[model samples]
Target: MLLPNSKRILLKLSGEVLMGEQQFGINQETVAELAREVKAAKDTGLEICLVIGGGNIFRGMAGAAKGMDRAQADYMGMLATVMNALAMQNALENLGVHTRVQSAIQMDAVCEPVIRRRAERHMEKGRIVIFAAGVGAPYFTTDSGAALRAAEMQCGALLKGTSVDGVYDSDPKKNPDAKRFDTVTYDKVLADNLKVMDASAVALCRDNEIPIVVFSIREKGNLARVLAGEGVQTIVQGNK
Candidate 1:
């Protein structure tokens, strides 16, 4: 499915992708390559916002499963996202791309607070804004944070760059015969539990009428191709 004309977009990336082939944590080479791909897309004149998950460093749910307080674990996960955001910001700046890191949780030393107008101005000045901290609350995934920011920023679409090329009926890795959908409706995704994203994230996009384009960011040059409506992806939107 081809993406619609989008002047601004929010790119939601799984933090695990930042790990490259490592067991955990960010890989410098992988981050650099991803930055280049983002730079290529930016050169096309599209305003970009980024939200990277913290699964690579810490996963709140995983911690909670081990008997940790859910809220405390989630807060730790949020901080991890800030670290990832900083790494990405550094990489983008190294490539001569102006970038900003806005955290939902305020940290005067490292980044700016989430100010909607300020973020808009940064984008107006050709700066990519990376939002961190997952809505400044517990039990919320970065996916939900991405959706909230996309709606608030009035982004044309939310581009989810993940390991998989598109949403499938089942786990493609485990189920060899899993069916990949070119286009799927939000309602179906929620009903069947397709896992395109967390339920809250999907519902937010549905309510705001923002298209979610899921594609493989691991594939070099795929981000640009998807932005150009030429890559393999699944477009999740309101029913046609």
Candidate 2:
């Protein structure tokens, strides 16, 4: 997929990917590999920000379903994301890639608070900033947080790194004949409920004119390839 000219991007990764082959929790080796891929992309001179989900550890909706207070459950979910961010930060730093973890829910002792200007400056100095805590509020997913940060940072594109290669017409896991789309319109995604992202996230990207590129981050060296416009990915854009 040929993406638009994106000098800066916000990459959203699901917490499940950190599980690797495990049923739950983070796999250090896998995270190390992902960090390398991200480093490669950064080496290409593209500024990057990251937002990671907390599904592997906890899901707010699931907690709510179990009769927990919605807001409290969501807060736990947000903390899970912060943990993931810390793990990612460790991996990236171990690879000798300078990184910073910025949280929407401030824990100044652990990470810096969300400050757009500081984050921009970090990127300018070649440091990757990881945003955590999912918009710092309840009733929102990390997907929405990614979209919001992408818009706030004026990222050229929003990269969704998942286990799936691209966006499929149906649940590819269940439907063997499911077709993957190389290019899809944001409206089509929203209208069809493609599950590429939450409707709010998709709408935010659409409204901001930022493309969403969905690709498999599990694949070795794929992040760089996708950023270079030569990898398998689904590009979601305005009426594409």
Candidate 3:
């Protein structure tokens, strides 16, 4: 229940969350559930912006490892993000939540190009703006995009919904002794390799002084709880 501020927020969702019980692609039922959560959150009157990753369908680095050119692979990854945005837009609209997909790579055929002021206007009008594509460039994960979008929109914090409840000293899945942290300094996370996020993402957020909340998105109401400071999660903050 300890928010740094009551300003608008940017939510970063991994594409793997959309996979649900499937091995790949999207699961509409799960997406609907997520949309309902967003609807509830939006009902709280907090302006929200979204940035989703394309890992479910593909990751540029994964493709490049298989022989595709790095730039071409990254563009492919960007396209994957657009697909997710459209899917999310559909689910949100079905729930009566007006949403828009804005991509960094001008894709008018599918969605609007990312226009800062336009996205701001959308938020003002109570619409959720979902940002897609990986900064329209290669070699960067969506984490960087999320940080950039959060900064560009002046969001209070970056909510990174993940499978784990919070950041740990090591991979909890592999290391059962990896201690979960409720609060940590940004430098500590990077120095100790806590995997709070990628180095680039963490560096950008630390530079911008944004708190990163890492929590479980599958815990039903955890997002709301974390926003209220009642959830099990890690809070990575800038050092004094």
Candidate 4:
């Protein structure tokens, strides 16, 4: 189902998607294409907020597993997200789309601090706001940061653009017969460990009454199509 009058929405992207077909790191060509897709959505008169993950460059949990200090590793991961936000900002600006990178971690030389009112003003002036650094804290994932920003911004919905077309009962990659859901309850996602997102992120959206729309970002023009309610996607909401 289409979101009810989605004037403003949060678009959450995984950093791995920026890697394109490569094994690691940001791929410039891929970022440009994604920027075009975002611009198209913005041109549709929708205000956009973006939150990108840092797994493409570094994953804090992976570092912690390898014996690095969890907090320090997480900080490194946060910086990686800033790099991504800057790349996206550059790409969008090249396309003549006004964009701002508001980071949770203070970095005045590169981007603005995460000020809710300022971000709201930026959106009002037609600039896309990209939030970085995952709530500026260790332990919390970008998914959690996205949920927080979605709530703070009072976004109509949270659009999770991933490589997969939608949420499935199991890992579609591992299980060829995995069943995809057109609609799902937040509780079911949590109870089933569906992995639509982390448990905390799902709970935040559920508590705030924000719908989460999951769709494939790899598909060309899919973001716009999903926003139009004409693309393959899974909507996660509270039980009716």
lDDT of model 4 at residue 220?
98
lDDT score, candidate 2, position 239: 65
lDDT (Cα) of model 2: 0.94
Residue-level lDDT of model 4, residues 119-230, one tens digit each, is: 9999999999999999999999999999999999999999999999999999999999999999999999999999999999999999999999999999999998898889
List candidate 1 stretches off by more than 4 Å: none
For model 2, the stretches where C-alpha displacement exceeds 4 angstroms are none
What does candidate 1's lDDT look like per residue over 1-240, in tens digits? 255568899999999999999999999999999999999999988999999999999999999999999999999999999999999999999999999999999997999999999999999999999999999999899999999999999999999999999999999999999999999999999999999999999999999999999999999999988988899999999988
What is the model-wide C-alpha lDDT for candidate 3?
Answer: 0.89
User: In the order shown, what is each candidate's alpha-carbon RMSD?
Assistant: 1.0, 1.1, 1.1, 0.9
**Which of candidates 3 and 4 is the stronger one according to lDDT?**
4
> Residue 162 CA error for candidate 3 (Å)?
1.0
What C-alpha lDDT, on a 0 to 100 scale, does residue 157 get in candidate 4?
Answer: 98
Clashes of 4: 0
TM-score per prediction, in order, is: 0.98, 0.97, 0.97, 0.99
Model 2, 75-144: lDDT tens digits are: 9999999999999999999989999999999899999999999999999999999999999999999999
